[model samples]
Target: MTNWYKSWEEFHTSLSKHQNQTHQLFRLRSSTSVSQRNKQEVHVYAWMTSQESGQGPANDFVQQVDTTRGSISRFGTKNVGTHNHSLGRRQFDNHPSNRRIDEPGLVELVRDLSSACSKAKLIMQHLRLKSGQYAQKQSLYVYAPIIAHTQSYLILGKQATLRDVHNLVAKLKAMRNGSASVEERLKARLREFCTQSGNTATVFIDDAKTAQTITLQSQQMRRFFKAFPEVMLVDATHNTNDAMFKLFSFMVHDVYRHGQYVQHSLMENESEECLRDAISAFKEFNPTWEETKVIIIGKDFGELALLEREFSQAKSFVPFSCKKKYLRTEMTKREYGGTNSLNTKRAEDSIDMMLKATTLDEYTIGLKCLFYLLDNVKLRAEDPVPHPKHTFLQYFMRNWGSCRQLWAAFGRAGIPHLGNNRRARDFMGYLKDILKSTMGLDECVDTLIFLQSVLRT
Candidate 1:
């Protein structure tokens, strides 16, 4: 008996020899036969030779085993029958011979199972590829549309950034060539694809001259006043050069809905004609001037007569005494050297402080200064004889004098007025905060909605 275990090399050598050899047979017989009634039977047989049998060596040997065993004692016949049965069973289990017994069905089953596993693997691979491609495609789709629709222009004679365009082209190239070389043939193919897809290969350069002309035309002074029918606040400050004219603008409270229209033009001289022209231009822009209302808020009566003549059909000319209105009312009454005296220097100083108050902290400091000035004014007003030399100091003592009366006058007429710089600054600060915190257009809309809700409440 040989050991069943062998190394792969040793097993291969043994298997190779077994395949080349003719068929091998072994026989076994029982010790007793039923016919002889417990008598032992001995059987002798000779296997046939291939040359004499005229059959192949392997077939002759197999047939000889069957004949010899079958002709022996009954015990030998039984042994031969069992061997024959095993041989027939093997005919359905082994290779070519087993192929006859629904072999195609077995082959197909194996092929089908292999095919199913292969298809499943392929599907998983395809899904992974598609997921990656989809992400890439999505990014390209988003940015490409923006680039295609982007309005390009040159500023200071320099071209605008083309980073988006370059990025798009790079992404398109990457999509076409995953791991392949970027050959001329591939480029030609890409060009053809772009053309078919309505994507132009040429980059159109924006004309600087044309862009400038368009921008100027777009920015031309147009009638935005119709949309906001309220008092226009007119004030002027000379710039460092003092050559060119620039007017500072502010809208009165009612100007947002309906009120007086005010305008300013910085002339070499504060002439009546310059004022008239400014008022005329304003009225021209306000075509509904016949239907609409007008109120002019000026620092003084500088252009009052001209405005009245220009807008004769409109309401009364309301003179806004910045000194009396803002300085006195906003600064506690005691600050203006008593409510009786209107001092110019103190008013100027208060206005300067208000202008300097840029931040919230600075604004609080200015208010504190105003409080101190108001207290000083009250002390002076109580004096038996107010010091004439303290005229500069007395202006601060008056607390803006009759400015409060002006505010009341407008208020009675259902007109809105931002009485002082502090109030204007506060409103501006609120607007700034709203703009800074807003995320985007949607957020801005949400903020407006929230404001509307708050107003309703």
Candidate 2:
């Protein structure tokens, strides 16, 4: 079982003889060796089989060696041939338990009881309080161990922590959601919708890495477009889904003067190509898309241009409300000092007044007033220096001045826009109430279809 040497010379001779001949002797770390109360050193050493000695011991092996009196140390050797030393106590200690649930049956029972609850700590508390109730219903043998474990770790302060319960609950949730990817689930829901109704939906995969876009329109959407193809409002909302894709909503006015969503597309980005793909889907699903006479959009010039090119007969207009919002955003810049400057306020008022001009002549006069207010800033007697609104003035003249008719009232005076962008803005508020930022893509699709059904009512 064990080999003992009497003399230090005999132990050294055996250690030297066993080095490469039959076995290997290795000294354990000093921490493994302890001194007794009398101050006698008890060294720890390891002796491994010659076959595994060249590769070193697979695990730590400690043996109490008697170093008292130059007598040889008591050496203990494990038979590597008969028994495997690979699986030591450290192997069990190093096991991965991040996703492991110690009480899986308890987790499942709790999950079944509390499907709506998400807080792991609360669920644990409920379980601890009502363990007797569950034990009465289910097997007492099965729950007794659970109750004991819970009391030991949670109440009595043992090895387990609260984080352990949270991790186990998270693992349970992951398993409950199934193994399908989010995109696959989204596509499955779309396919199920198309099969249930005579609707159409298509997904455009840009590439493996880049985000994708899904364009969908129901049967009622087609009828809405055909009934009222004169005007349309195009806008986008973000953070509606976990994928961070922008949900582009194309709405139109119904007979009741209600803004109804006619088409929707979840896009990766609002690039021209992505918009074109969405519009192409719209045109394919609704033949009356080309009959749109008026389009109201945001401050995206590229989107405006694309809409013009796609619907050549349609006139696109960015309403005054949107223009005011854009201007106010620009006016808040630190570079322009602030909007309280006389020149900045005058310029803003003049622009607002200019956008309301009904005739070209009136617009021309309003433009002159705007320039005069910007150029002739009445400086206080204390400071005679020119106003620092040159940056804002230049920005306005370069961007807003160059595209006057697009945002001005006279641009689409001949066309009917109903309430212009008021209906669209209201719809955005409605969308915020229904959708959430943490929703998955499949959940977003389901919510969108539900909203469409509600609007149809």
Candidate 3:
């Protein structure tokens, strides 16, 4: 029967009395602590077995007291075995099959493996391999004692599983990164670059609102800018780091006719002020920046206006391919043909002809053809709801038509773009090859500089 004791001492006194009277042994199974009325109480469990019995041992006597409700419970167990619950017995008398490493070096090996984020099974295999025990049966066998030791070494206070190792690695990585602020880390990396390359790169650190920007241009880049400043390409990449900052690159064609990055800026956004600051850095470092004659870019309108204001002499050229992609996206909008594939293709083909026109006369004819096709478009009986073709026509007129001379082929006929205006697009693929999606700004800067050094040589 279960009884509630006022203290742990009282419970032990009563338990000893039962053991002496019945000549029984108690093996502690486990214990659980509960808080009741702002006070902590523990419930201890022990299974009883008779040492020398005339009748069978009372294995069915189970008592559990719920301290919260001040209630008692009793249950029966069918099996009971002799168990030595003494701490000394547990320390010396383990199963013969259980493995333990007594060598100091081997024990430290387990700790090293665990610290290196090895899984329990893998660590066991490595240990077994070192001991020349390569049996297939031991492949999945994990030594519990080594794992317990590893847990202690890692300060985990419990058995170390695969997830625990992963958490440890993640914690260490976070601690390493947290040792310095973002700005400090970036400045250190820049300093390392300067020490190695012997080039005093331009850097801008803004501590206001955490929208700090860094513009990098080495001395070699300055020489390239002065010699080959006829063509320039500017583009920005997103999701480069956790801060959501955009990386903008200003490139120029080197003497070898290869697109080489002259300047790179990591900014908080594409705001005009940030762009102006980056451009000003460029103009400050390389005096021949105004000598740039042709600037090729994607469809960043804000960048276009800023570039126009800063480098008015340079002709801003957007590739026809970029315009085609944008126009095709607009064609799929609801006000246009929506999901009507046939109408979309027809509109796209006519627009492609207009954009591919070599002269103003050919452009006009292609435009008339587009208008004619839009006017004559008919909806199929099985098709979904049709949209007004005039919507796309109006959109083109309002957005692209007003700036036809900027993106159209006829207007860019005489401009020298080194046979293409997609230099920025080509460089994007190279950047993606060297950069990962999860790199921080400091790592990104280091990687870019390392690769640039390799390319510069």
Candidate 4:
């Protein structure tokens, strides 16, 4: 009865004013029952306030209170002990055994491993070094940081030192050739230098055949228009070897868009068929080429006629004629006292002058020099002076006789000879200035630009 009342709050409340003290007795009964079950505490209060207010039937209320009292007694006596045993069984499964590394420890371990790896790499490199290997090895391993520093100096138009290269090589050795290390370092260095200094490094590769193949595949004459669309300059020169003359057509390209000649090619020999073949080669490269786009053809009078017949739609500008007139003037100036005949000493003097002038200017100085030499020979012939077996006129005529035709062609094209001796001297001085200002691989491009700019001015 005490257990029944202990779980039944409605029964105590239904007792009215006498039930207040009975409710206190029910609480004492709940404490005693909880202690007898498992030494655990349990609270027994009104489950529903409406039931306590006598709103339901008494019999139904009493039955509900009895069922709840049985459920509480069974749970406290059986379920609570079973739940504690089950929690003990799952203790290992609920929690992990091993403790993970903290963030600071993991970071330190990584740093230590990296350091050890670097030291190992250095030791391996030291082991590999031998007295014999240094003499045979030509390939170098350049580093990124060192190359970067070298490029910085290069960008400021300064040359990289041997110390810079040595430092880079040392870094590369330390890296143990990590991820694309060599290629990445080279590419980065090239990109920085090429972008800032406009210089290209000439890397010598093992494949000579591949280099030749690339040159042939990249045929400048055939791909002239595609490579340089703006302005194309075409000219032809004749060369004599073993007293036989061979004509060579050439085309100049302005690739940098800086109004400077970048590339050249030998088109064909001196014949109508060869000229036609040259035209065909050009057409093969650019099928859409029209007569108007042909622009200019700077050639000799003989080739001029053939060029006109072949490319009638194109306009031809002759700069070599002025060159020839200049040469003839110089020749006449040398012929004041003597006739067209040249003496032995005079011929030798003339040859020396021609060779000297040839190195001074590109077109004019050469033509004028050759003209003066030839005129000196003509003066000696009129005088009829007997000379040795090896005469200047005879030597020049035998070896480089065809060069006269080259000069005449230059003159016919209206290209002035490097003017007078004073002008030639000035041009040489300009060339010397360029040579002085330019250094390293950049000299090639700089010299070309200097020449073009001088000509334009």
Candidate 5:
């Protein structure tokens, strides 16, 4: 319920009631409280409970908080007592569903959902659109009813509120994903999908065993996996599905210069064995999987080392981001003037900025500037010219200088994307939204195939 204030003084007085409260999030805005307040006021958006924000009874919540003596915490007790008793429980509008079009919540819903629907992912979470019909709005009327039922409002007309749209989407997902047991529903869907899509998907599930893995690959992915087996990015993301299994993404770029997700695997963990089994399955899907030489890039050497064995000709590269981090860290040593002049922070920033340079000319200019700073510091002290023996330059040269081709933009042969955990992390945020990625085995399949479908178009 939203509480309102007539003037700043009133609002301040009410807020002061929670003076000793901490870590409570608050959002305030000017709202037309129409059917509720029908007066000029500021509103506090909150679910009414024992405490203003459900923090609980405060030890020292008075205007003049006394912490010296062991003061009894009676602050939230008043709210708690008030919350428990039904006397004047009208704090919540029992029949708020009868509110008019000008109601505060409905108004807020309309305002927020309009902006949210502009984004495809958000709209998908909030709407009930079927596959291939994501863009089509055949029955806006159907979505409106979802709002009416959830909010207890009789939606009379064609005009739909943002709240209605979002609720409808949620309702649709609950239905489409179905209420079948996680395993049974998933197995059925997997069977139907494999039959329909002409794609290859594999699942490993065992009640007796602790961990499971599911892998999905499309026809486009199959072709790319077989033809140009070069440059695969391997990374795992967590918490995108219902189960807490790690969602590992195997990515490669196709001839068309687009970043393609060739395989999606859900594993119990990122263990070397799990990864090895997952990668080996690529060959199972197509015997010619490792027919061509491959280049594998990843953050984990444990996994990459195993790939070396499977594909002998496969070259391994570290993500450029990881290499940059290592350089930045190594320079932050005490000998490098940790926080003294020629500081590590500045050195690290310079190196990072220089590495991101896309062209050789830009990189050369950046390198010149970097050496000028490092060299100047050395000459100013008349210190023996910097050498590889003790300085960061030595470690850098030995570890990464010669390998610039593996991490620098100019060195990449038109490869547009690097396989990094960041990409998977970002996608997980969008996939999970407020719900888990997969609820069961079937839900896991649905989630991966949905991702594959999105990537396809």
Candidate 6:
């Protein structure tokens, strides 16, 4: 039976009446939703249980269907193990059986006599790795709670040390199946994304001989794209998974006037063809893409060139970091690679002026500094040894210098200095911390979607 009450008093009275009449025990828990903006939501969960007067911690539970050898067993703790001595129960209440500070590994003769391998193997999850436990005392510097855990779950005597359990884990791993697969799993997850996002989510996964591309977007992402189609930032991160896949993200400014990266794609490489597939999918989803300004704040100018060719209508943005790197590299070579002449001295000081330029007036002064350093007459009589010249500067002036409107903030009237797509990098770090390890393709997508939903709600 279920009922909804408007007031807490009313609900409490009704719940008390049921408890008095049925004499059933119940537990109360809450789920909290906290936003990055510090907004909070709390949901109260109160339910009945058949465990009245149970002799254990209220939340500590072991889901055991049977004592079968290979049956699934879960020793779950509600909140990372809280201590409640008055209740005579605690989470993970396992203590080492050995009283000594040092113990030797089992000899071959003793190992032959031991027969608790199956029971011990049932406890450890990670391959040959023991769980880090809190040490309780100084005398038992070498004692492990994992041995106690194995004993509690399998009801075994003191027959296996930590090493014995690890050996068993290694043995079982050799006989186990290969790494888990994920194609079908990701497809199922994408289906769920579509439902949760009211069919606004878009997903496309294709496997080719040379490349694999998986693109995903949620309602929030689409909404951002629809609203702010004027500016788009594209970037890719490498070594994000075991398959050596690169994760790419597309971002736009949100209504709050903040950067919101709204899409993720896994690709085999940052090649033009691979990136084109991902960008075209997003471009097709939103009709206003042609009005958008595309920024490629990633490595590889070839990728940027491909984007320029693919979306010629959108204005391109070159990140300030790349501009600084090019300026510093070529100018430093001119300053230090040649003699201590007046030209080299002037070049050394000019590099400082260009880097610190802020406004249009200041930027012009910096350009004058570069012009002086780039003058071929100033760098005359270069050393016999390898030295800096105007070659790198000349190439840049003929090609990139003409595109100041794309790379220089001073050229854009109202636009602030859009340094790099750092928000995407920060969000990626948060996701990595959440998973704490390299996750499968399906699992990674599912986790990101869940995080998006949390932020949305």
lDDT of each: 0.37, 0.70, 0.68, 0.36, 0.58, 0.56
Best by lDDT: 2
What is the TM-score of each predicted model, taking all chains together? 0.26, 0.62, 0.61, 0.24, 0.51, 0.52
lDDT of 6 by residue, 80-130 (tens): 566543221121233333321122232222233222223334443221132
RMSD of 2: 15.0
True-vs-predicted CA distance for residue 129, candidate 2, Å: 14
- Best-to-worst lDDT order: 2, 3, 5, 6, 1, 4
Global CA lDDT computed for model 1: 0.37
Q: Against the correct fold, how does model 4 do in TM-score?
A: 0.24
Instruction: Answer with 2 or 3, whichever has the higher TM-score.
Output: 2
Query: Is 3 or 4 the stronger prediction by TM-score?
Result: 3
| Candidate 4 residue-wise lDDT, 243-310, digit = tens | 22232323333344332222222222355654555555445445445533333443333566676666
- How accurate locally is residue 30 in candidate 3, as Cα lDDT from 0 to 100? 55
Q: Which is better, 3 or 4, measured by lDDT?
A: 3
TM-score, candidate 3, is 0.61
How far in Å is the alpha carbon of 17 misplaced in model 1? 99
The regions of model 3 sitting more than 4 angstroms off are: 1-169, 175-178, 195-198, 205-211, 339-342, 377-389, 419-421
Q: Runs in model 2 with CA error above 4 Å?
A: 1-173, 207-211, 343-345, 377-389
lDDT of 1 by residue, 1-457 (tens): 7757459788666665564463443333556558664332322112244445665343312322357556532222222324433333233323332122122332343344332323333333433334334435444221111122256521111111233223323343355445654234334543553453222221111344211000000001223344454444444333311133323233334424322212223233345654554555455444655533545454444665665666666443334355446544643455434545544456456555544444434433443444445345333322332332344344533533223233224222544333333333344344344432212222222333343235324
Instruction: Score candidate 3 by lDDT.
Output: 0.68
State the displacement of the C-alpha of residue 378, model 5, in Å, after optimal TM-score superposition: 6.5
Per-structure clash totals for the candidates? 22, 1, 0, 29, 8, 0
Quote the lDDT for 286 in model 3: 81
Give the C-alpha lDDT of model 5.
Answer: 0.58
Off by over 4 Å in 1: 1-221, 240-266, 291-301, 313-321, 324-407, 410-412, 416-457
lDDT measured at residue 454 in model 4 versus the true structure, 0 to 100: 55
Q: Give the TM-score of candidate 1.
A: 0.26
